[model samples]
Target: MFSDSTITENETRRDLPAHLEQLLRTICFRIRVQGREALKNYSITAAQFDLLQRVYFNGPQTMTKLSQSLGIAKSTTSGLVTRLVRDGFLDRRRDETDRRVFTVAITPLGEQVIKSVIEMRVRYVEEVIKQIPEEKITLVHNALDILYEVMSPKQH
Candidate 1:
């Protein structure tokens, strides 16, 4: 996230607004806390969930690739993957041509875990949104839509 920020000599609030950053940070913190509670029911840790999501959405990746993509040390990812493999949430396969090279992929159980977690999150958010004023709720929803558009990568 910090890598995405661009610092300029003559910085203005528009360059990077503190209030906006604070609001986003607070929301992210609350959501993460709620996510942890939801994930606990499935016995999934944040790191595992993150790895599962990456493999799920972007296909299988080599140990090196996954480590680089996650910006974590390979040893750490290796241990995490080892646990996931032992827990039946991931499959670690050695390459046929290169026995030393291995790729990690999510197992069926991992998909189910991710699905269940998403369902839990949806229900949790639904419950929270129910308590918010209808008008304000719509405003936040629209804001997210706009934010996504602004943040999304443009086509070449």
Candidate 2:
């Protein structure tokens, strides 16, 4: 099990917010620990999986869209996309309306891999949370909704 003892180390509770750091670490740790092996099955890393998921669910997208979705730089997303394209997980094409613009979509193989990964995730969640009551599931959703709202970026 992952230890969270360091979350209580800082007692200033003033200049620096310990809870925020702890929250970030805990979330990262959980994803790394829980999703590590699951990712290996698809020959992907966590970052790769995140990118692929964004594409699978919300693409055919421009590099800008992927950068924004992944919270990384456009250059970084471009590199990731390049590697994916090389691996045949995605295809890039110029937009007909604007030849200068490029977009990407999951290839058939990518779709199949993503589909399998999704099913694995669904089964994992069901098995892990099966003991929780339906009412608690609603509570979890409500809590996440609040968290999402709080963490949402401010629009310019």
Candidate 3:
């Protein structure tokens, strides 16, 4: 039969996963909310910012690819691309070899918006991290690195 202390320890170990999940969710929610606040300054919606960020990082992509990446309907992606293009944040070009195909690329203006949003988000994180003690910061950083390394996809 297990002692009282051992039972308590076993229960805590079982509960650790739930505590970790809540912490992760809370952190992500707060960061996303902060990002939305940053987007307001750029006069862009979160969805639009996501689309632009994807193009900015991944280079030009076809409408079908964008739709897939964004997990939105083709029609929805078309509307977004049209609005972004009209706003001069994205440039759409017809393929030379396949006239029916079109590619969407982020414009310089789009890049500027993305950079600004990222800077704002980073600043927010910096401010939050400043509250933590110097020594604990290293431990937190190391823990996050390990978490990311374990969760990241393995290269074939």
Task: Report the C-alpha lDDT of model 3 over 1-156, residue by residue, as the tens digit.
Answer: 877567676798999999999999999888767766766766677788889999999999899999999999999999988999998899999977888999999999998888877787788889889999998999999999999999999999
Please give, for residues 28-53, the per-residue lDDT of candidate 2 as tens digits.
56544654555666666567767887
TM-scores for candidates 1 onward, in order: 0.79, 0.59, 0.87
Query: Which stretches in model 3 have alpha-carbon errors above 4 Å?
Result: 1-7
Worst 10 residues of 3 by lDDT: 34-43
Better of 1 and 3 by lDDT: 3
What TM-score does candidate 3 get on C-alpha atoms?
0.87
Question: Residue-pair clashes per candidate, as listed?
Answer: 0, 0, 0
What candidate 1 gets wrong by more than 4 Å, as runs, is: 1-16, 96-100
Clashing pairs in 3: none
Question: Model 2 Cα displacement at 21 (Å)?
Answer: 14
